[model samples]
Target: MKIIADLHTHTIASTHAYNTILEMVHYAAQAGLKAIALTDHGRRMPGAPGDWYFQNLATVPRRLEGVLVLRGIEMNIIDYEGNTDLEENAKNLDWAVASIHGGLMDPNVKPTVELCTELWLKVAQNPMVRVIGHSGTPQFAYDYEKVIPEFGRQGKLVEINEHSFLVRKSSVPNCKKIAEVCKKYGVPIVVDSDAHFCTELGVYPNAERMLKEIDFPEELIVNGDENRLYEYLRKYTKVLEEE
Candidate 1:
């Protein structure tokens, strides 16, 4: 299968990431990507953009240098209850991806897995959320069985983050488990670079290899087709409007 879109990525606005918006666009074009999302870190992160950045996203064109540009944010799940730091502003963006960062989840907390999973489902069910980024990361041990079906029912995409696999080796088994649950539930998965620099944008060969190794269904991966993604985005936009 041929995948053309990378839906999870960061820009200079994210403190730890390295690259400007223009640089990201240029690299994505060079990489032959049809579309990409600018999912910079949420406000809770040290170098994340301010409220003004999200509010003025309209200034950035929907397409840049022959590639579709999706204005988005990777919001932090602020609590086990699934409340996000930028919940109020999420509605305005083209796409909003909810994720678990260091501050939002306490690994030592009792019932960490159960609570985190419950919260993930809550966030997935929220009308404003289009995707759940890096749900497989071991640091936040969400209940895969419950979360996968919840995402399927809500038409939300579960991300298979490329960087997470290399950066968090301990989470490999958890990621495989999540993928298995998604397959059983018929939930679609989105493979993303989760790249923080121009060099990393649109790089999904590692994820592709992993999925192939597991004999994953091509139909469940959204990055394989641009038209399908446009349809998905339309539904996502509708959800945002309703919110």
Candidate 2:
């Protein structure tokens, strides 16, 4: 299953990420990708960009290097109540990926399976949240059976983050479990490189292998084909409309 677009990539704007937007887009063009999203981290994460950074995304063209460039942000889910660190300026972005990152939440507040489940359910209802980033982290594990279907109903694309396999090795097992439940519920999913560098863009070997193992339906993968990717953008975002 080849993905024509990668909807979760990072750039130098994210600090920890190494390449610039032009570098990333140039790589995508060379890779023959039809689209890519520049989803920098929200302010809550250490060294993450500030409000003006997101508010000024309009300056970035909708298309770069003949590839669709989605102005996006990966906001941290800060609490069990589903509150995220997304700034008001983020409303102008073309996409938003919400995820629970370790150390971003309160230290004293423990996360229970029930609380995690509730948290994701609430996030699923958020209109601005289009992608659910790496929900397989063991520490933030939630009810896959209950939450996957809700995500499908709310039109949220569950992400199969390739970076997790390399960085958060422990989440592999849970990630597989999440993929299984997603297949059972026919929930749409997105495979992303979650790349921190230009060369990493559009790379999805591990995630693709995992999904193929479970025979996950390719049609349900939003970025698996160009037609599917465009359909999703047209239906759920103003990216195409503005273009």
Question: Top lDDT: which candidate number?
Answer: 2
lDDT of 1 by residue, 1-243 (tens): 777888889988887888988999999999999988999888887778898888788788887898888889998888778888775755678888888876655556654788877888789778777888887766678778877888988988988888887786777777778888888888999988889888987777767787887888988887888777877877657422432
Per-model TM values vs. the true structure? 0.93, 0.99
Best by TM-score: 2
Residue pairs of candidate 1 with colliding backbone atoms: none
lDDT score at residue 178, model 1, on the 0-100 scale = 82
Every model: Cα RMSD to truth: 2.6, 0.7
Model 2, CA-based lDDT: 0.92
Candidate 1 lDDT at 211 equals: 84
lDDT of 2 by residue, 111-220 (tens): 89999999999999999999999999999999999999999999999999999999999999999999999899899999999999988888888998999899999899
| Residue ranges of candidate 2 with Cα displaced over 4 Å | none
